[model samples]
Every structure is written in C-alpha cells, then in structure tokens.
Target: MTNTDVTQLDNPLWYALKGAQQAYAIGSSHIRRYRSGILPFAAYDYRSPGNIAELDSFLEKDEVFFLVGALPSLPSHWKLIRELPCAQMTLELPPAPLQTTTAVTALTAADRDTMFELIHRVQPGYYEPDTHQLGNYFGIWQDDKLVAIAGERMRLEGMVEISAVCTDPAYTGRGYAQQLIVHICRTNLEKGNMLFLHVLTSNERAIRLYEHLGFRQRRVISFWKLINAGTILGTKL
Candidate 1:
C-alpha cells in the first residue's frame, strides 16, 4: 500500500471522525469530536467563527480537549492552555527483522486496567480510560505483568495511527516497545494499512528509537489544548 497519502493526515481527527471512527464522533459536518473520555480530541472542517462557537457548545463548562492540527483563532470563552508540538512520523514499508524476547500477547477487556496502569505510569495525559476500545492493543508481559504496549488509533481509509507505544520505566531499553511496534506495522501492512505516529518534539530518545525502527519524520504538528473556561478555577484534564 502507498503511504504517500497526505490528504487525511492534515486533519486526521476530522477525517477519522467523519470516516471509519464516526461511530464515536459527536457534532456536525462543520465540526466533530470524539465522545468525551474515549479521546479528548476535536476538529473542524472550516476555520469559521460559527464553527468555533459550535465546538464550544459541545464541551462541558470546564471541559478540556485538543484540536489536533494548526491552532485557530478562538473566542474569549475558550482558553488556550498549552500547545504540544509533535513530530508526525510514518513507516511505509515493513520493519527490519525483529526478534523479540517476550511473547506479544493480545490485550482485551480483561487486561484494560493493567494496560491503563502501565501506559499512565510511563507516559500520562495522552491515553484515556476507554481509548483501548478504539483499536487492537498488544503488550509484552514479564512475570505476568504488562510491561509494554503499542496499538492503533485514528483509522483512515488506508492509513492507521500507531499510538500509546510505551514501556514500564524498569523495562526501558529491553526492546519491548520496538517489538510491539514491529508487530503493529507488520500486521497492519498485511491488511493494506500504512502506519503513522506522533512523538513530542522534545522527546529525542523516543525519536531515535522510532527512527531506528524505520519510522521517518513526516512533519511537525501540534496538539492544541483548549478549554471552555466557564470558570477561572477549572481543573486540568
């Protein structure tokens, strides 16, 4: 499959919400968002003030979520909290020979709590409580514990996002994440899906690991964190 398709990547949330993942979407053609808790993300087809107002109404008074692309002009009711710039990377071809140590186990509802614990322990703020249901997840187990995990998110027509790739701090450098990534890419490739992912620009170690695993930086994108500040003392999400 050709991974050169950049049309959907520009506004992945919009395309995903309007396409394969529409079942979890809320809002209209002008603006769309994932249902709360599954993924705190929203997108707009057009950058109009009307669309912005429509988006604001979809949020709770003190709700926090992200616009996964270039930031747009906002009304005073909406507040810009933080901007997370990320290197959007892609891997077109199959990964090099990957010989993993631990067996890769398919994760399920029974393992949801453990998966949440491990992902949040290593990296927080991205993965949500019910995000696991969005796609298939696989993990590496050590002594019956899930030490590492990687899985799909934001499915387009021919593209899929590889997300939540993390390892238990103690299990770092054990090639567990690399193993899971290869498995995801290889499996998706067989299904005619090209793989992509995003990493924080400040995370050089992770960038290097992804590069080593055949992922090339496609572009830099920002996840704009915004809030419907009904009150000044709203809590962080």
Candidate 2:
C-alpha cells in the first residue's frame, strides 16, 4: 500500500488502539491505552475536553503513560512529565543486503526468560515480558546464549512494526543486530507487509545504521509522558 492509502500511518497509536492490537487496549469511547504491561502508549481521538477527561480517568496516581502523535490539550488533573522527541521511520520491503554471517534462529516460549534478561540488561523500560505476543522474534546466539534480537511489534492490516532491536552490551559490534534486522525486513516484505519503526531522535548511531539499511525518516513524533497531578513525591509506576 502507498503512503496515502494507509491512513493509520498518520496517527499510528490511535489506529493501533482501534486495530489489530486492540485486544490489549482499555478505555472508553474517546480515549484508549494499551494495558500497562503491554505498552506505555495511549491515544485519544484528538484534542477535546471529553477525550482528555476520558484519558485522565484511566490513569492512576503517579502512573505515567505516553501520548503519541500530535500534542493534545490535557486535562488539569494530568501533569506533563516529559516530552520525548522521536523519529518515525519506515522502510520499503527488501532492504539492501547486509552480510549474514551469524546464524539467526527463531525464538520461542522457551527463550522468554533469557530474552527478558537480555532486553532488561540492554534496552530496558520499553519491552514487556509478553511483548513476544506481538509477532515473531529472531535471535543470534553466541555459544548457546542469546546475544541479540529483533522482532515485530505493532501491526495493522497492511503494516507491521519492527521493534525491540537490541544486543547485549558485550555482543555489540559483531554485526548481529544488522543481520537480524535484514532478516526480519526481508521476511516481512515477502509476506507483503510494509515495515516501520520508531527511535529516539537523539540516537544518531541507530539512525545512521537504519538509514544505511534503506529505512527513511518519515516524521518527528512527540511522546508526551504524562503523570497524574495527584501523584505523591516518591510514588513510582
């Protein structure tokens, strides 16, 4: 599908709340969010009083969640904790070839514990224990240890997000990440799905690697992290 054909690309989180990943969503008519363990993202129809009120009702004291897409007018009970600027990137199928030296293996339930450990040690805070439910994951093992991984995350009818790409700190610079990304890209393209992903704007190293692999920066998205105004000084999420 062409860019114009996929309206969901314009407001990805909102559409995801209403699309394939909707099973994980919780909210009323105007607002919706993925369950806490699934993702920290939430989205509303747009900037409106009713939508803001509905969103506030779903948040707990001291709990934080991200509002992705265009900035919205928030309710008084919600506090703007932080604004993270991110780059929304998309790639056409079959990214340029990369040397596939390492053996990439499909991961399964048996690998969950080790996967979580590697993710927590390297790319923490975002990946959930059950994130594997989103789609297939592939890993590069070094001496029987999972040293790197890349996988699919969000999915709409015609597109799938390539996310949770990380490598153990000790395993970096080995070309594991690059190979796995290329594998996932080629697999998704063969399945006829467009690929997209998000990365922090400040991560220039990752940006360079993705661009070199044929992914292009689409837009700058704002991740507005909001906390309940009633939160106490030391409470945690």
Candidate 3:
C-alpha cells in the first residue's frame, strides 16, 4: 500500500480539530480540546507551559482530558492519572467482506443510554456521554439487548479513527465485536476515508483481530490521561 501523508497520524487529535472536526473544537488556535461531553481530547502545535496554561483556560476545576503521543509533565495543577500507550493501526486496503450472519442496525437516539453503558462497561474513560453524536454508530441486537457496537471518533480531513468497539462479556467469542468492526472499516473505506484504530498494546486479542481484518500497526501513541487539580500554589489551575 502507498503511504499518503500519514504524518498527520502522528498527532491525529490536533489535526482533527484543526481540520474536519473543527466544529467540535474549543480553545485557542495553538492548543484546543473538543467541546465538553463530546470527547475529552486536547492537542497543541507544540508542548510548552504556555500551551498548557492555554488548555487550562478551556477546562473547569476537577475536569479531565486526554493528550496523545508524549505525556507532558504536569505543573501541580494537573495530576497525571495514567499513561495509556496504544498501538496505532491503519487499514489501507479494504477488510474482508462484512459477515452478514447477524444484523447490525444503526444505533439511534433511543439507544444512547444503552450504548453509553455498554461502551463504558467494556472500555471506560476514552468515551464521553455524548460521543455518539460524533459519528455513525452501529450495533447488534440479540436477545432483545444491544450486545455489540463499533463507531468512529477523532476525525481528520481524510481519516477516521475507529473506536468504541466493544461487546458485552456474556456475548464474547461469538464474533459480535468482529462483525461490527468489519462493518465499520468497510463502511468508512467505501467513503474514501483512511481508517485507523487505537487498541492498548496490552490488548493482544483486539490487536490480532484488527490485524486479521487487514489493519497494520503503524505506530504507538502514548495517550496521557490527566485531570485538573483546580488550583495550586495560589495560582488558578
């Protein structure tokens, strides 16, 4: 496959807010985060105390947010929660034909609570309450319950990150998550957008699944999770 300016992938969140996902952006030109309750992601043109302070301006006391790539050293007002290093994989070629054995329906407004609960249950912290509004999400209903789901997040001009791919524990090993993933990858590729996903490097099972579906490991981005400490040293945090 030909490499076509995947440099933007190096700092996907920042470029995303600067490009296609600008409407969801907040903060100054150099440093920014997504609108509250959309996605708790922030990016900057460069890392510096000034940028950190600028980002601080966009958040409230006790707020939380994420920064991918290198985890910056916090200045008392911000506390390091966890450094989640992830394997960044990309799909240049189309995935295997979507297995249609199970019906994957487009999740609607009615399914928001169910979707939120399931995603947070399986993969908490990355997703926000209103994250479903960011992109088209699909699900598989079994036994009158939403068992599996996969959807988009952190969008750039011509790229989309596949996220929230999860399934109920009782529904594992039946390929429910796999089906939703294939459907999402295929659907996004058909729209001419480059596809990529971030799975924790420790999640060998999920990584293998994506690889089997034709996603190759492009790099590893260390996503730093941080929380606002309100104020410290008598300075507004």
**Candidate 3, TM-score vs. the true structure?**
0.92
CA RMSD of each candidate after superposition = 3.3, 3.4, 2.3
The list of candidate 2 runs beyond 4 A from truth reads 1-4, 47-49, 231-237
How high is the lDDT of residue 181 in model 3?
84
TM-score of 1: 0.92
| Stretches > 4 Å off in candidate 1 | 2-4, 47-50, 231-237
Residues 1-237 of candidate 1: C-alpha lDDT, one tens digit per residue: 755457679888888898889998998778888888788888988545356667765788878888888676776778899999999998845689876467999999898889888888877877788898889999998977888899887888788999999888888888888899999988988887878899999999999988988889988999998878773324332
- How many clashing pairs per prediction, in order? 0, 0, 0
123, model 1: CA deviation in Å? Answer: 1.7
The residue pairs found clashing in candidate 1 are none
Clashing pairs in 3: none
The runs of at least 3 residues in candidate 3 whose Cα sits more than 4 Å from the true structure, single-residue gaps closed, are 1-4, 47-50, 232-237
- Per-residue lDDT of model 3, residues 52-139, tens digit only: 6677778778888888886555567788898898999998557777546899899977888999999999889878888988888999
For residues 1-237, write the lDDT of model 2, one tens digit per residue.
Answer: 423346677678777777778898898767888887777778887644355566656677867777887776666667898888889899943577765667899999888888888987898767778778778999999977999999988787778888889998888998888898889988878777888889999999999999988899889887788877672323433
